[model samples]
Target: MTRRRLLGLAALVAALLVATAAVVTTRLVADRPAAPSAGPSTTPPASPTPAPTTASPTPPPGADLKGPLNLLLVGVDTRVSIPGWEPHADAVLLLHVPAGLDRAYLFSLPRDLVVDIPAYPKARYPGGRTKLTHAMSYGSRVPGDKANPSTAQGYELLRATVSRYTGLRIDAGAVITFGGFDKLVDTLGGVDLYVDQRVASRHRRPDGTMRTLSGGGYIGPQMVYEKGTRHLTGWQALDYARQRYTAGGDYTRQRHQQQLLRALARKIVDEGTARDPQRVEQVVAALGRTLVYAGGGRQLIDFAYALGGVPADRLTLVVLPGAGVSSGGAYRGEQLKPLGRDFLTALRGGRVDAFLTAHPSLRVKN
Candidate 1:
């Protein structure tokens, strides 16, 4: 996948990860297929769902959760069909569940933000500066050297890069593929999206040609959206999240990604996807296919359960504090500042609310 498309998938993965916490229950059967005994596979298991168990009492909505959680949400830019291929991390999000689970903080890192990659034995640069996104590619494979790196190695590089940049460690993480993203959205039926601005996509046409406007230049794919609320299918949502050609560029893209997550969460809860065992099973199955979980399933499930009652309004979205600048010619990077340092300080001290208060400009609409 191209870098931008991969970023879109990152948003999708976050939605799925969060949704799992909302929908999965212990009583829910592990209907998805099992993993290969010998090695890790990108494919999600498909165990059959058993008969329904006794109905349980519904928890009160907006229930507050206990303890804090940290997750490194990474969108892997590789085809699910092609297992074992190390894809670059197109999108990286730091999903933080604070001491009170009533709210969430999703912090985004621009892919072009430059950072120093640590030296890996026999690897390029053995440690040198590069775009944050490249850390995944470099760690994913040895390339022409034929010494392939495991998916975990790629994540380690990414985790280290994020920690170095943001001063927060990833307690757990998951790598979601494009295929898994498509499946989860389709299973959810669709999500409601509130567009901040009009978006015109750059996806190719069915004729293998680029879409164009009446004024002449190519318009790419025609998944256009006005600045209003609308429902998006799995494909439409992905295309919408991938848009980056507007005036806001990556910043706008990140905002839309955050919106997509909120929209998906609302749909999952409002539409009652969490209460239906069969549906939850299907959703979990779809997630299994796409998720390369860093923390095992049980912990994520427990985390999700704690916060499932929380609604979209409680979730907060914030981009890492920075301004975009050119590196020389065409290369671009985000120059982060004292805001980043301050935010990290607050985060480490378990005072995210203080950080947000100090940097009101960093907050975005949910």
Candidate 2:
């Protein structure tokens, strides 16, 4: 059988590479696909830190490195927000890599999650309750501000907001656009994934058409994906990741994102992308150009090498338990109760395994 068909929560530890290597977010339209032969472009915009040289030191087996690492992964709707569109954080994932770096835990924060945002200069609403996704945009939306809303200042606000919610110190982050993600997938050839159930998307068709359904809901005319093992290109992967209308709703999309996240990391490891100097340079350039990074590329490479051996079965996906509620009779929101509060406490205490053991239901089973 294909890898996707055989895939499950078997060994997800290697999957931690996606977040630990470089927590990514974005959706830029100008992010055209680099030519197949394209080499690294002139130094990518100012990176989180200077790029490392070929002779950079590697961590020794027992080196005294920092303890558990917490990173915030922000995926934005930059593709649909060019020019006149409003940018928002579509996917927010909290990645925790323990000091051991043997396994990883990923927490998906729903975009529609309601939370209190601290006041910041240029924020549309100075300190008020709003959707978690709006924090990034609000940080750079001031009139006459020339800064890009998804860059430096904007991401800091997002990091702060996420840190507040998770109670974990977020040290680094990365933002990748839908377009960049698509191209990256294509660059890796394609990814294979298993679906627990059939999935349909509400995204527009290739011809830019969305079939309207009864009750005013819109989805692809044909089912976007069927249950079983499936090979997905960049575009198809994005569509699959955005299928919130499926049986599990937004929860399903979060699971799919993790699935894709692991699949991509697997492809990178299997292909030895990091070991290849030219390929590494190319990837660094593309990511630096298309995604925003809060940490240096060297740190990302170091973590990737350290965690490359982890098996997929070791990776655990955790979704904060919550329920959907209609707020103000207009916007839909998700509220996590005891589970949310309790999870943060576990995180603060560095006892996620205990927490997960106690509450297995929150674990993503697929």
Candidate 3:
């Protein structure tokens, strides 16, 4: 029998930790963040998602977060002060890392996931209770209307909820706001992706027009399709990843994002192996700048080491056991419900551990 795993709650529950560094990368130099705006360079446009941070990545020995670990990546929809487009999470993922790992398996969790928000502070939220989407909003949504803070707070809320429910102790937390999302995709020279369906064509168009592109086309505000795999720019990647309507809504979009991550992981691994240390560093730095993380270095390294411990064949995205949509209950943006039992079962039995044992563990010094 598989024992349920506890979602790591406390570790990631703290507020955001901002890593403000005048970092340099392939696109932008250390001293100048706006430098890349001048012209094109050898590096891809390095715009990262502005993730409000909480913790620095952790590095340790004999700690728990090794060998087949599962992580939940929260994409917060923050209202950016920038001109057009209201902020909303393009997607959310319940990503899993292997014990003794290197990479991670990502599973998209719809923001509108209909589940019990058990840990919601009753004193704060007197409106009874709500769906899981609030978990993501907790960081920014300030009950009435004071002012939204950062994505870091949202991850903390989610971490708490997941821990209260699943009982998993995660290593860290991070958020990729809409602004950060656009930048990161742009920085990647745009991520190559494909959409399986038709979706709404505008970011904030009052006119309800929907255009369907094939598979290979430059993405922007409309659905562009070409065939097979094609190159995408930042805006295009965001549009592609943000397309939930084509795949019947959030589920399809989430899956598409997962696919993109797989491709991205492959590219990154290849870059690292090719000994393009400089290039890899550039990418990592860009990622660090944009991604608001609870922790860094060791946390990511441990997850990587644990993930690397498992075989590719066994690297599977463990679906948190449960239903997605509630029977007759539906909320505006809410998508599915987390399977309480299934989530715990996977964790306690260490489904990831079995995978780690199947392969081999990688040792790293913190």
Candidate 4:
């Protein structure tokens, strides 16, 4: 690419990156189509903090100098305005954070690729449980009379369950809802992602004519994305990242989220956006407000600093190998799958811990 073209592309990419973070809020086009939400309620915007221009945050004091730290990254699919919206998790990412600087590995968990919902309330289902995604759905929509909301509890269970299911000690967990997610996207400007396939949507509407996305066939967004670089607004990016109805399904969607998040990070850093105090403050505030961090935020920053050291090429992406299939459910039919051995084996054999050991300064135990 010519220098001019490259610069333009980079600028476009940077804008898209910022857009990804800021675009966390958009009215849900269709309520039924989305997976149940982990919680309802619009997350209040976090109060801004002064951005630090110095090197990234120092890890928490005495963080386990052990090997790689497992970060349970979760994506909640609910519309934020409705508190405790129980949407099935459309995406799950397990970030294998190395001790120091080396790039971390990202393991994508297919949402439909169901696994047992650990600690599901037996009283309600009688049978014990349904799809893993329903773990939140059941927690929320079960009626206040029958059961309490599962947003916080669901997150806790997911972390515990994933660790047990995968046999990796997760150091921390961070979850961002659809609204916060949109904001984060916008904060990053916008994200440039290659649509792997045409995303078709128009299933129905009150209009006599069959309705689709705002654009054309199937309606809303372009389902069949040309296989090349393209700028995606917050809505478009979310649609691309969240939509899993493609022929490839959850696997594709999971990878797409990881890619876009990573891309957003890269573009931001490359564009010097992270150095901007206002932008940094927005990010930290956003995280604090919409995101729930099971552990310390300072530690998470330190983890980011350590991850920032790695070359992108060395970064590995792994998915717990599995498939999705429709499972029987009571209120709404659910889709589910098993968390296979491959996921565990990948963590066990991936030298993740070993890599972390190689770096000393980054290790911190609390």
Candidate 5:
């Protein structure tokens, strides 16, 4: 799937993680199990319920979460209800919650960033250098079964690729589909976001239906998101986030994705949705229906308790500097600037706060 079509999925995983952590302490509970080994052949369970095993008891609400945790959040371009379709990572975000757990840093990795994908024997993929997004597609192939691809297997490979690139261990990860993302927004009664730029949807008409193709481009009255604060329904928000034709292109889209997530998280907390038992249940159920979670041996609920204290205001959005790479006059992919690499180095050393302080431009204004 093209990255443009599934851009909104990034916001879904981020919003879900924060929302789940914010409210799970109230009533969510499940048996904790031992952390699964990497590259397990078994498919991830459809729901977040951990396997029944006598491992460490689930942590209580407001428990102290370990510091310097890195989570890999990916938005895929597939539907949960459908099978036999290969999925690619449409949106890739890495969330870093400092040891204090008082705040979190979220950043996006351009889906088209150039990277070296390692060989995966499970899928018979002798990987090569390519766009980073292709790692998921290469790893998802079922060795003998061409009809169905394993998202879990694909996630493992993607995780490894990201870990290698960033030089950090992925403590946990989660995957959500585009369909699930729509449901999540609607479940919360939509979201209110500031339109940083006017964006015209390439896939949708003014009435929210798919745009028709003519002369190699969409033909219809475009759905336009005006520049201002507006309350948006699920479809509208998704369409807006999916647009990359704005001045900043994918970078603009990335900012919007982060804004959407913050808006969703703010709504959950500001509206008291997190504290309401019934509402929390509805949100949790919606997540259960949509999310494929891997907590690196930790339960989702544990993360909830650990990160419960992180409010929306404390979350910071970061944009890494990069430029387009081309070969033979053909667009190849993206490469990070030197400053971006330095930021990653700081992240590995737990000096992100200091680094951002020194280079204020890297921090996205709220």
Candidate 6:
């Protein structure tokens, strides 16, 4: 069998375990997706005194895993093997499941969105106004140790920053490195995505090799993603999702990322990957390596079961209207338009469905 077919055979097996076992010993860590290649630089700030730990809000054990859940998923571009390197929140997404538990809303926050990141004592970062992506780097610093950054600590501060910005209590979350994301996609064979526009990769060549730099620009045949439904390998999918130089820029990239996510989820359900025990084993092993899941004091299995009812087709991709912000002709960052603020209010009030209904343009048609 082809690698894609072989890997896709085991997708979402954990969700299937919910029906067969009450207590699953298998542990699946939460994982974030891969971010764009040309994302912002992540340099750790100066470390001060070690700050106290600020734990995320966790529900009591055995608490009902009902509807209206918010999950924070982040993709970072950090290489653990490289010492003294910090991670940046390259891709930030919020998954909101309504009370019905039958559907979900996935929305992306602009990495360049300027926001007030509160002081994180753990990283000794005082509150400041900066791009959204910096929150991860500022929070990931290892206090008193500039060489090693803590991804977990970084996540805590990011959680705090996002919660403050959106006014949503994050029930659970996961952080995944770019390599891990690549591995996860490869493990599932590949993903089939609808390319809305043609995107020429800025990083990769036609043969899937890194482009050589020449004359302050990359010189080589580009890996082009044509507009249409295409079966993308792991590298292809990651490369496609990272393109932002196109007409729509980052917004277009965000839409592609969200679409890729839905496509992966849909493939698992549509292909009946859960029935084969061997495939399940393969998928679980891949997930174990790539994901660092935080269940908010609950077990991963609980989440699997609670979310089992949600079908991939019901996953709705939401677009928050925003534009680039500039001052004195120099690009500062990004700010959400008024409509985006209204959507956040709707999310906090648990009326996102109504909000989308009233503002249909915000909902991206599948």
- In terms of lDDT, which candidate is strongest? 5
**Between prediction 4 and prediction 5, which has the larger TM-score?**
5
RMSD of 4: 14.3
Cα RMSD for candidates in order: 11.3, 10.5, 13.9, 14.3, 11.0, 15.0
Residue 177, candidate 2: Cα error in Å is 0.9
Per-residue C-alpha lDDT of model 4 across residues 1-366, encoded as one tens digit per residue:
122222221211111122222221110111114444568548653655745576864443234435466766677766555665565555666767554534556656555444565544621532234455655555444444432355555566666656765678877666667666666666667777665566643233322233455544465333345567878755556666765677666666666776676666556546755435566566556645556556534333333323333454454555443543543743323332333453356456675455445433222210
Looking at model 4, which ten-residue stretch has the lowest summed lDDT?
Answer: 23-32
Worst 10 residues of 6 by lDDT: 14-23
lDDT of 5 by residue, 310-331 (tens): 5556778999988899999999
Which regions of candidate 4 fall more than 4 Å away from where they truly are? Answer: 1-64, 81-84, 98-101, 120-129, 138-150, 201-224, 284-288, 296-298, 305-308, 324-340, 350-366
Candidate 1 worst ten-residue window by lDDT: 1-10
* Ranking 1 against 2 by TM-score, winner: 2
Tell me the whole-model lDDT of each prediction, alpha carbons only: 0.65, 0.63, 0.45, 0.51, 0.75, 0.72
Better of 3 and 4 by TM-score: 4
Model 3 off-target regions past 4 Å?
1-68, 82-90, 98-104, 118-128, 141-145, 194-221, 272-289, 296-299, 305-314, 318-344, 351-366
How do the residues 186-230 of candidate 1 rate in per-residue lDDT, one tens digit apiece? Answer: 889977877878887776453424466557666555656778888
Model 6 Cα displacement at 16 (Å)? 20
Residue 296, candidate 6: C-alpha displacement in angstroms? 1.9
Clash count, predicted structure 4: 70
Please tell me which predicted candidate would have the highest TM-score against the true structure: 5
**Residue 83 in candidate 5 has what lDDT?**
68
